[model samples]
Target: MNSLKGHPKGLYLIFATSTAERFSYYGMRAIFILFLTQALLFDKELATSIYGSYTGLVYLTPLIGGYIADKYWGIRRSIRWGAVMMGLGQFLLFLSASMLHTPGWAHGLMYGGLTLLILGNGCFKPTVSSLVGQLYTPGDKRIDSAYTIFYMGVNVGAFIAPLACGYFGETGNPDDFKWGFLLAAVVILLTIVIFETQKSKYLLSPDGKQLGVLPDARQQALSAEQAKSASAGEQSSRKWRNLGILAALALVFGTLFYLWLGNDWVSVGIFTACLVFPISILLDSSLTKIERERIFVIYIIAFFVIFFWAAYEQAGASLTLFAAEQTDRVIWGWEMPASWIQSFNPLFVVLLAYIMPAFWAFLNKRNREPSSPAKQAIGLLLLSLGYLFICFGVKDVQAGTKVNLMWLTGLYFIHTMGEIALSPIGLSMVNKLTPLRFASLMMGLWYLSMATANKFAGMLGGLYPEAGKEKILLGFRIETMYDFFMIFVIMSGIAALILFLLSKKLRQMMHGVE
Candidate 1:
């Protein structure tokens, strides 16, 4: 128990489960774009579109899964069923890769596989995260440390997946991609076995009660009423009113995003959901003023988070392209696979994970630690700096010459620091601020922000400069790699500054939680 920074045994159990689940995900993701463009003969634009839509939907479905877990399936059952779906999804991807020459079957099977993955992730992601928070009593200082340890567990898989998957799938021969997908499927099977066998023994509350049991609706409603006095009729009316507002906002946002995104339904759906869900949470009749304000903090931080992830997630698209097309990957005349570069950020996270938690704890003990939102603002700042650092590396390179690999390694290192500041802290903040009844739902909302950011990431990746192809955003041209990288610098930097200004108020809203 002391091994994971003095966390509960259940935390490590969750760590194991999440490690295997992320292995399945990041393993497949490490090679997914390559599969689309190389084996299926799709162009870069089409492949990025598919990648964006798939990743976006993967986060978006957590809303559904969260609702179910909160009301029906409960956490443990959700994990098991979700794992099965993801395992099946990976198997389908393996079949799709195996039949790459048969374009019809390959395309169909790929879509089928991606659908299961999206739905499955919806079920798996939020519940497991909520489980981590549930392992400790509320207001436990170690919650942050526990999540950091869990985050390292996640990165452990992320670190290994690319090395394994990229090696098998990114070989010059297209047919070999199936082996990577097969390995992913196998990992998901392992995920199921580990969680099912261990959950009863280890996934328990501090007082020794079995956790993740089905939620009691009447008890939840009564608890909500206790938080704020509201008659049932008034609550019903408020719920309807919120639903109506959500519908109207969705329609308006859907139209705007669809127009801006050029008829992409995926972008429209993601953006609309991101805008509406938090507002829906705010309008809940049962939330006290304090609860509502704290929830607003989650919303504010989540908005900035979109900027961070949109810039960070270039790892999958434009960055991968950069690694493949512009980075020097030779070691003694043997070229490395581009996808292996995906492991670097996660590698940095695993290396720095323990150090980060202790650093924060030291500051906390000294009464000098920043609030959650401030730390996230710092994350955005570091993200911008990371891109700005890399901008110099590519500024003067000739069209055909590649930069050294250390440039990417340097960029990933800085970005990993930013991720450490933002991602796990955000998870812990959500856990600390939210009411118990809304735990999974709020976590789902957190992932919904990622859904929007990933869609934006896809859109941004489309702006990657191609030879003789003109790309423009907000009247600015993207012609050089430096120009493209600077976009993130400016975008994230401004967001960080704005968030810094608001950090004090957001901390006030937390109302002593910190």
Candidate 2:
């Protein structure tokens, strides 16, 4: 029945589920930093630090969530639990905002809300992502298109969130923030309802079996046998070696970050795990030579992804602040809320999502489609240009001068195109490259890169030029908007060049998958 159609009905259901979940997430995120500064009464630097750590940990827990899904709960159960936790998290934020008069309870509730969010996202992100790929058979070209569709749902939520949340939360008064948080909590309930009611009927394989069921009994038995094959002494030695390696990596990275950023343990932990987990995947004894090479390709592409996200995620922090304090928002005698500016990227994403996949398809028809890594390299290049565009807009502007909103608008437009190229394509690539048994875990590892980047983004956001605060990075002093934006230009430019050079080698490593 489904053979003639381009995609299954389930894909649309996944789209709905993802859309609701993202609305909940991005809605809360739209004003979180503002909530920190205005409601919680923290400074910009501290708010960005907390913002970075919150976003970073939100991605990091996916590793644990993915592990749990693979080993115990399965994706369906994990997602349900995750949705509930996130809903509760948003509700707590509402309570926190409602109690703004009591600073201590407000602060306590905010942290508690953020904790639930982090744990819940750990469960939700990777599982939903992995599920999209599972909808297709191996070698099906539609996988990329499906993920882009799913990605559009993600952006749909992002596009609307800031408008709704910002209007309610980011009004001139701090007291209004509770309404935005409450809106997010309500949206999450929709996600639970959509998934739970529809999943049994629509979330099925081609042969009519249910998907995301518990691991096969035979597969568990096979794993048991594999464990039995390893001698106790050998297992002990391997465990110690892995621990030693992890310890050494943590020490080296922790010390370096401490020197560079001064005792930001969150960045140190996230960054250290970024390197350690990818390497640990290589340490698995079951991998064949071809599998190992393909895995390396994922690692290589993921390493470059760190730079893309670090710059791109500035939307939620530095860019939002720029919109608030430095951009001329007055249009037709109305000033837009700063948090609304965060919606631009997602708005562009929704517009461009179809165009990008079709563009790739057009290239594929002519046998001219770029390799996944090559496309990602192009994305990095576009990211660099976006920052460069903004750099020009900000150049030589006086301190206290607000530039046109068009400047930030243009940057979001270009960056959205870059994101279209990189983010969903990268998800499609990970699913293509991963072995079936390791799908969830590998997806978790992919997100681990973003965790590191987000933490780093927070550190960079702290460097946003404040009048009294002098922040120096790598011996260069940042004293203006130009200086701050240039960091992304240089960082993403170099990464693009290097990744472009390595793309051919990496494509070959994929062993004909692309």
Candidate 3:
């Protein structure tokens, strides 16, 4: 029995808690915009802005969450509090969702609900991600594989949430929408209960037993290694005192620079990160040559990943709306829900994530496995092609009319193909490149790029002019939406080419670290 127990009980606890929370989050998020527009009668632009801001804030807060977890409350207690906040948030969301069409009260409830959710997710996201890191031993090979498995859990929850909950969210029956919100609340409550029940078995001590000391076997060994390295002329640990001031400086610098851009503080801060952190790393001489080179390659990979997400994120912002108000969902006299279209990316990730590793293994054996950068470049190209299909397909439909759901479906397939090539691999790359000391921080930085990309996607999505006459190609007139897709395709194609040119040099920089 002991031999079978290789992984920590804490890891399973994290998974269970995360799955329930993701279910609740995605369940609501998948349909949130449509709920705002259709149910609350907000203007399209206002609703889009609201949704964009909500999601952008969701990604942005993990910086604070990670900090608090590392310094004070720690993952287990933080997650416990997070689960409560989330449950409350879901109930508030239900209140809003149920009363959405009920005039002035609805708007107040909506704002309150959004606030609770934003705060709850802030606490939840970073603690969970860090806890996953805590579960493995130092230099454990299973660690990376473990996260990949956990990543799959996230997508699995994401995949199922929309389809099952989306049906209720947008059902023709009014009761179903209310029921959906209520069900979301229930899911969050259950998550809280489950975690509480298991906490003693897993995380009786949320913080380490010793103040300012490491907790697990992994951290114990890590401290020993650090001692040896320091004896061998490495400098003493960068004390906690310096990190806060540095991070504060970065935050302040980022804030001042981006506040002028828009009201979107998150959008500005993270783009500034994509600029600032890598530069700061370069200027630091304390870093090992290996660390500097590895981080440099990581930055280039992050850049390409940014391009990939800018296109993929369209599934929620522009693409979902297009499906709802525009796409001809009446196929065989059945009206498919627009939010359901959002489900495909997660669905594909769940089914195909495992398969791709095997495919890579086969390709590696044949000496045909493309490098990570090459795979990501290919992902960008495929995403570009997906946008091309959408650009053309939108044109093939009647003006001011809904297009076929099949077009969206086809586009998702292409997006998924691209995702398989790059998405999981990107996580693996980040984990590989990041030094253990800065592991959590680097992961936070990678997500910082995602946060920015998401915001940028929305900002650019808002750029599709409502009344522009667009160009035609292949006997189809490209509307504003199509033109947008074309722009993305061209943008990514150029990026992919540039990255491919630098691919060899960047690979050399990695020095086989990955």
lDDT of 2 by residue, 56-112 (tens): 999899988988998888888989999999999999999999999999999999999
Q: In model 2, what are the clashing residue pairs, if there are any?
A: none
- Residue 247's C-alpha lDDT in candidate 1? 90
Quick one: ranking by lDDT, best first? 2, 1, 3
As a TM-score, model 3 comes out at: 0.82
For all candidates, the clash counts are 0, 0, 3
Local accuracy of candidate 3 as per-residue lDDT tens digits, 1-514: 2112466556666677778888888888778777776777666556666776677667656655655655566556667777787777777777776675576777787778777887777667766675565555445656645665677777777887888778877875543565666777888888889877776667422243321123222342354444565443333333443455568778877777666676666566666766665554455444678888888888877877777777687677677778877788886888888878778887877787778777877988999888877878888888888888877787645558767677888899888888878766676677677665455456656666666667667665665435543444445454556665776888778877887788778878877754
Q: Which 10-residue window of candidate 2 scores lowest in summed lDDT?
A: 215-224
Pairs with steric clashes in candidate 1: none
The candidate with the higher lDDT, 1 or 2, is 2
Those runs of model 2 whose alpha carbons end farther than 4 Å from true positions after fitting are 2-5, 216-262
Error at 232, model 3, angstroms: 20
Any runs in candidate 3 off by more than 4 Å, and if so which?
1-13, 101-104, 133-145, 172-178, 199-266, 273-286, 464-479
Better of 2 and 3 by TM-score: 2
Question: Which number leads on lDDT?
Answer: 2
